[model samples]
Target: MPATSTNTCRNNAVTKVLELEGLTKSYGAVQALRGVSLHANEGEVLAICGDNGAGKSTLIKVISGAHAQTSGTLRLNGREVRWSSPHDALVHGVATIYQDLALAPQLSVWQNVFVGAEIRKTLFPGFSILDKKRMRAGAAEYLARLNQNIDDVERPVADFSGGQRQAIAIARALLWNASIVIMDEPTAALGVKETAKVLALIRHLKDTGVTVLLISHNMDDVVQVADRVVILKAGRVAAQGALEGISPATLAQTVMTGEWPQVQ
Candidate 1:
């Protein structure tokens, strides 16, 4: 079993966007997660940090509906939800941006952004056709709102920069009116400038009232973007608290050592 924290400050902000209570998952004799619990509030970015085999990926998969919890309660906006699959979670406005970005390299920018959920219209009352104009216009509108300027919405996303491609993926989630956005290693394999752009876009999402769950092994990235941090070890929460309540040194130590050594 992983550790738990009972020391919570009174003045902490309220407004829970996502919560996991007693979440557990097992495979044969090995337990992937043992009663792991965590939460992220609206307009806040929660960073889930842990080393390899820490069950970080497992937890996110459960919450994002990729995997079901063997035993636990999953709640969104104070209501318990039973998500059978990733699509089920998406129906509830939960969007996930995986490590690969999931963009079709061969597809055009607008096509990729509006791939699964494209806009269509009816022409001549009965015979309906896809609304290419509205989609192009809407995609352009969304990208522009994010301070991103892509010359051609019809251009293939493979031709865009890493930062621009990430922005497009995020814009797609926003277009769906997603309430909870989960990003896995968002800044991985990017240049310094590209990383900065991704961070700026994440802040933009928070400012727009989107709850963010950021999974990263990079402490500097977590400290820079996460409002709260949840450290997991051996499939259970080792420590969970506001970023302001803990120092980076303490956080690093807790993750690497898996022991909550009292701060000196």
Candidate 2:
């Protein structure tokens, strides 16, 4: 497949939802990130790909506020900001869905969706209780918006398939009104059908105006859904631009060798 140029992938007028400039992270004497920089445009799917030990995890940790960068600036919606913690980032409309999916197996789908942030009702001036009905309704609405049909939102997540669990996780993010959603290898361990569903859901997210930063080793998934690709090599950005005009083989080669292939 011919790759599309960056200019042709998306309109240049789209707002940049997240921006990182000269970002670096270090642990004692060992540096994990070396001045890596990139930007995710609004309503675009940006795939981050690299070989093992390429600092992909570290970069996302910094973006999610799990770790602070040693240097460099992070801009959200064009404004510089520092996050004190992951919750701080979430509060600012940034949400991360790790490979684990983070759904509680013992809890119902709606319960998992609003675990830490449940709705509440105050019957009196000083009394409040969990609003189970409202939470269930909200969860159902979000799931439906994602075109996910669950026979019962009250059912435990352990009974659901891998793809369904991922949908619930994404629904939770949407319920929080997240504008930027970061997914770490969402299709990992999923069967072909399940992976296809998740890929379609990711495309749905972009269509709904959500910016996605996807970190994955699956070139096929990235090529299928990503509007742009960022290749990281040993904690530094090797190559990045519009995915247009780039082939999966060329992308894999860039990940392994940290150099763009010379066109013949």
Candidate 3:
């Protein structure tokens, strides 16, 4: 998904890489989203925390261009954009990793990394084939940059551990020069160690200057990586602010009740 929406951070430090204003989506008479807004800043991690049916998936779908907005502005770097398709969002450097991660179990790591956008070496005047050598080398370079220790880029994705597979998916996004990465329930079913590894990768992305919008119900992961928390309740923003400004207890309260505390 492309980083299509931006909301101002209550904290006063950075500029938003993406913004959404009055974003709405509907399915016939049923409204999935209504006038919701949020933002992800450059190099910052923004977490969207909400329970099931809180409109999180709809929000990501709209932003990713999997679903068109019924009304509102999708802004990247403050300019309103009307994304017509998911590829349009991808062309704008927004890459989304759904819970599925979109990896091919039967394909080699390098092949999956360059699946649609494979590099070609024109050996003759008009012929081109997949450049296995270039692809392998480039895949190794990217994996190494992520500090991953995969010994064989030729091996299938199913051979890699969960963490390594997640790393490969992330590296694929980076290979495409994605500036904003949206990850939905990235750590959903992983064991403790795998979840830790994915969390570390999230931190690594933040340190490497990529803005991240993480969607998860895990409060622990939310506080650990997110600089700010945007709680989407009943298709609207119920509470949003710097993480430091809100406590875990308060966040949990908001999740259960859909109301921000007074903090008096």
Task: List the candidates ranked by TM-score, beginning with the highest.
Answer: 2, 3, 1
Compose the digit string of candidate 2's lDDT tens values, residues 126-243: 9999999988987887888889988699999999999999999988887677888899999998999999999999998888788999999998888889999899988899988777
Backbone clashes for every candidate come to 0, 5, 10
With candidate 3 superimposed using the best TM-score fit, by how many Å does residue 129's alpha carbon deviate from the native? 1.5
Candidate 1 lDDT at 131 equals 88
- Which portions of model 1 show Cα errors greater than 4 Å? 1-13, 245-247, 259-264
**TM-scores, in order shown?**
0.91, 0.93, 0.92
Choose 2 or 3, whichever is better by TM-score.
Answer: 2
Whichever of 1 and 2 has more TM-score, that candidate is: 2
State which candidate, 1 or 3, has the greater TM-score: 3
Task: Give me the candidate number with maximum TM-score.
Answer: 2
List ranges where model 2 is wrong by over 4 Å: 1-12, 262-264
Cα lDDT computed for each candidate against the true fold: 0.83, 0.87, 0.84
Give the alpha carbon lDDT tens digit for every residue of 150-239 in model 3: 889999999988888889998888876777889999998789999999999998888777888999998888888899888888888988
